[model samples]
Target: MGHPHRLGIVGLGNISAAYLDTLADSAQIRITAVADLDTARARTLADRLPHARALSVSELVASDEVDTVLNLTIPAAHAEIALAAIGHGKNVYGEKPLAARMADAREIVAAALAAGVGLGSAPDTVLGTGLQTARHAIDDGLIGRPLAASAVMVTAGHERWHPSPDFYYQSGGGPLLDMGPYYVAALVHLLGPVRSVTGAASRLRGTRTITQGPRAGAVIPVDVDTHITGVLEHDSGALSTITTSFDGAATDAAPLEVHGENGTLSVPDPNRFDGETRFFELGATQWRPLPTAAGYLDSARGIGLLDFIAAGPDRAARANGDIALHSLDVMTSLLQSAAEGRRLELTTTTERPLAVPLTAREVWSQRE
Candidate 1:
């Protein structure tokens, strides 16, 4: 615990910069190496980082200096990179959806378990104030006996601004897969685990044109559904209806809203680290913003890793792979339910992660 845990980052994409921003002042972790298929991009990050060296993916995962591999690889390659990191006997954490498929996610989990290394995943946005405050309200009984919830994410899609938006429409990419993790993770935090799901999905367009970024005017193929809606039956007797769509332009939908026996909680967007969390009592006329009463306030991307690290070897990390797998299981089942036109029972289950107390960032880093 005397030295910062050495982090080897694989995949230096747009998101990598945000993680680097969070890691800059982190006492719990430090970037020791970075890798990307774009070698020059890796070199660029290495130049800007205080002590990071540019290495090949293989080298970075195997580097003796690295204690954990912070995998930011695209969804399709998530398992390959994670399995490789675990093979090297290093702990691993990555971006959402765990992998392109549940099978790969299962493999990733199995390998990490066998290797005895820590496994964690993202949409760590749940570890932030927005979702945590809402959770605090429910746990505090401000919202009595949670009964139902809704998670909505509707947009025209990422091709509008992303330079290369090909992945968003690919087999591993879809509104449900790309954006559902945040909502699903947040829902699990609010209402335990999911037991089953029933879904319906549709696609009205076959192709899309990139409207912005360097690849403007480029046409991308659409291989997945553009619109998806589903109902989740949580084990705790709470039902959640979720809709994730790239086909819609806008909506008045709250990012998330949880209704209980006595009150309704309008949660903030789980895609971000912080925001206003609004709530309304049974007889209240209007919703009110809840104070930041739990979780890490004023935080960002890599805090998940910090939180995971803070949990130590003997404790369970809130963002651990078990929950990510459960979330992915829920999302994939939604798609399956859509195709089969029937509700699907989930094959995985996970406990609600322990709540984050209102601890200062420095204190988390200093924990044993």
Candidate 2:
């Protein structure tokens, strides 16, 4: 390898720790700089890395030592940080929902293309053994022709755990926008791009109290819907029903499932890197767990970044910008469809990303 990609991280939130943990031992990337709105937070994390230094958000984006910016900012700030990094000609990989709005997301994608910079987004979890194995099975005809899918995610609310859960209830935040990206992204990976959608939504509580962290007992206003249900029509004619909610206390529904002409696949949670992918054939009496047939083994949050950088110029990253934009469009259109009480055609679409060939942790970590 010529040299490890110099990485600058722009957010030090709860999610950042997970990425940091995953990238800590990577040989193909180096944490060169760290920045956060809270200067102290950046300094504290930077101090833990021998070669890293803390910088202001502006400085980090423009740093000569940095080649790529890992953006972990909240949904609302995604475009701002991404645009800044792209403006400085840095490759960017960020947490999901590319932007809170489709207009901003399109502008970000346009800016990156104009600047000739690489862009990627999260829920890279789909590239892990769990979802990829499912994809492999689908593609291998283990499930004949995929006809439909269903994804369900239900929880009381994030305010029960996330300290600063305000963002989860804000304009750009909600059950569908926050959690739907993972499921939608996975659906796109498994079935294909969505052509249109019909949706319905409801906000169960107007206010919620924080139950954990420093903000425990603090009440926050809810500005967006807490529950969302939708049916997606994939370009390939596969239909997927989805439900994401902060209103429900819990659910026994499987995280994801795909039905085909000859079999049914039970996919693990998209938010997780690995889990059991079960399948039931047309005449089978019991579901069987599929072997790990594809994707990164023992991977985590930052694997997508590694995959993005490794793609080089030959192909788009598995978690590239186009898919993120399409996922965003699917989600925003769902909300719009709900509000309008009608099915709406999506304005954006992307070819299903290439499936991740089964890879070991040691191999991908050292890959260029």
Candidate 3:
């Protein structure tokens, strides 16, 4: 390892803890500062690290000590924080769905390109061995030529468990925008970018009452579609059906499956790092399990961050900001297609590459 990169993290929300806990053990990057609208929360996170301080967003971005800014802020603040980091001449790594709107996402990408700084986003979940193996199998023709795919993501609404679930029903917080990144990213990885899309969406319920956490019994109104179904036409002529909902009950199976001419590949749950992969031959009797491989150990996000740090300024990886923004566009188009009742066309595509081979130490190391 060379010199460690200094990191300043913005957003001390619920998900920030997962990233911080993983960064605590990595020597490649160091958290030099943390910032949040809630100063107390920022201090709480800062206290866990040595030589780390809690600062305001402006201070964190303008400080010369920071080389990179991790934008863990909500969807609404993604563009603001990311653009600020770029304007301050620092690299940036943000959480998924780069921005709430396509125009904002495009602006962030443009700013990063203009600054010539490293910019990336997550849902890095595809880097997990589960998806990697699936990609490998697909490429190896174990599944023959890819023909079609189906992804279904359903939830009983976040109000039941999240302390503050108001954002989930909003424009940036709907099922397609919030959870669509993972599925869309995986699809882009496996099937490439979509050429067109058609969809239908609906609001399952007008209002939802919190049933768990501190906000229990609080009712939140829904303004966005809670249920969405989309048909994606891949450039390769392959098609896919993607459906997401906030009104369904839990099921044992995953939400996505890719079918090919030779076999049907059962993917792991899109939301998880690793699960199981089953292959169903054209005329097979039952689904067969594939060999287990090294998957992500620390919530999946760490994998992309580590890769970014390792690669440094030399080369870019699959989790680059452009790919993330493309995925966001796909999701956005899905919603637009639903509204217009017309097929939406896309101008970008991403090739699905084989997973990076795992080294011995990487496979053995366990999170403390």
Candidate 4:
């Protein structure tokens, strides 16, 4: 292999640890620098890595030691950090939604394209066996022709668990924006890009009290809608119904379900890396568990970055910027439709990402 990609990470928040754990022993990549709003936090993390140093966010993005920026910052900071990395001629891979708004998302994509740098987004969980196996089934005609799907995510709220859950209720953070990316990305993988959307939304309550963490018993204001329902019309003519809520206590609904001409497929939660995919044929008496047949087995958060690097000069990364931009467009358009009380056509579209062939842990753990 050639030189490992030098990674400079911005944002040392909750999700950062998961990525660190996934990439700690990688041979194809190296963590060279760390940065966060809290210098002490960045220093603490960098101290643990023999080859890494703590730096300010701006310094890290401009440093000669870094070739790519792994952005784990909040949604509001996503575009800012990404643009800085792109401006310095470095590739970027960031947490979902691409950015807090479509305009920023477009600017980031355009900047990366103009700078000739690769850009990637997260919720790479779809690259795992759970979603890929189901996609494999659909592609192999096990379900004939897919006609529709349903994605449901219901939770009381995040304040009960997350100490810094203020973002969950902020403008860029809502039940739909928080949890919708996983399901929407998975739907794009299972079905195809959405062409139009119709939606309705509501806010359940004005305030919520934190039940755990340092902020336990503290009340926070709710600004965005707590419940969101929408219909996505896919380019393939498949229709999908989606419901995301922070107002509910719990639900037993299959996290996702796809129905086709000859059968129905029950997909596991898209937020997870792997789970059992069950199928019920048109005439079958019961649902049967489908064997895992595709994707990176035992993969985690960093696999998407590895995949982006491995994609080389020949093809787009499965989690490339276009898919992310389109997904965000679909989501934002849904909310816009809700506000306008009318169906809205999407302004962007993308080809369905290439499928991941069944791959083992050892095979995908390193860059191909």
Candidate 1: residue 331 lDDT (0-100): 95
* Model 4 / residue 216 / CA error / Å: 1.1
Give the 10-residue window scoring lowest on summed lDDT in candidate 1. 359-368
lDDT of 3 by residue, 21-88 (tens): 66776667778999999999889878988868999999999998899898998988899999999999
lDDT of 4 by residue, 224-268 (tens): 999999999999999999999999999999999999999999998
Clashing residue pairs, backbone N/CA/C < 3 A, model 2: none
Taking all chains together, each candidate's TM-score versus the true structure is 0.97, 0.98, 0.94, 0.98
Full-model lDDT for every candidate: 0.90, 0.93, 0.82, 0.92
**Whole-model alpha-carbon lDDT for candidate 2:** 0.93
Across residues 1-368, which tens digit of lDDT does each residue of candidate 1 receive? 22688899999898988887788657677788999999999898899878899999999999999999999989999999999999999999999989989999999999999989999999889998888888888999988999999999999999987989899999889999999999999999999999999999999699999999878998889999999999999999899999999998898989999999999998888998789988888998997888899988777898898878767766799999999999999999999999999989999999898888787766654432
Candidate that beats the other on lDDT, 1 or 4, i.e. the better one:
4
Task: List runs of model 2 lying over 4 Å from the truth.
Answer: none
Candidate 2: tens digits of C-alpha lDDT, residues 1-368: 12688999998999999998878657778899999989999999999987799999999999999999999999999999999999999999999989999999999999999999999999899999999999999999999999999999999999988888999999889999999999999999999899999999998979999999887999999999999999999989999999999999899999999999999999999999999999999999999999999999999999999889888666779999999999999999999999999999998889899999999988988742
lDDT of 3: 0.82
Number of backbone clashes in candidate 3: 0
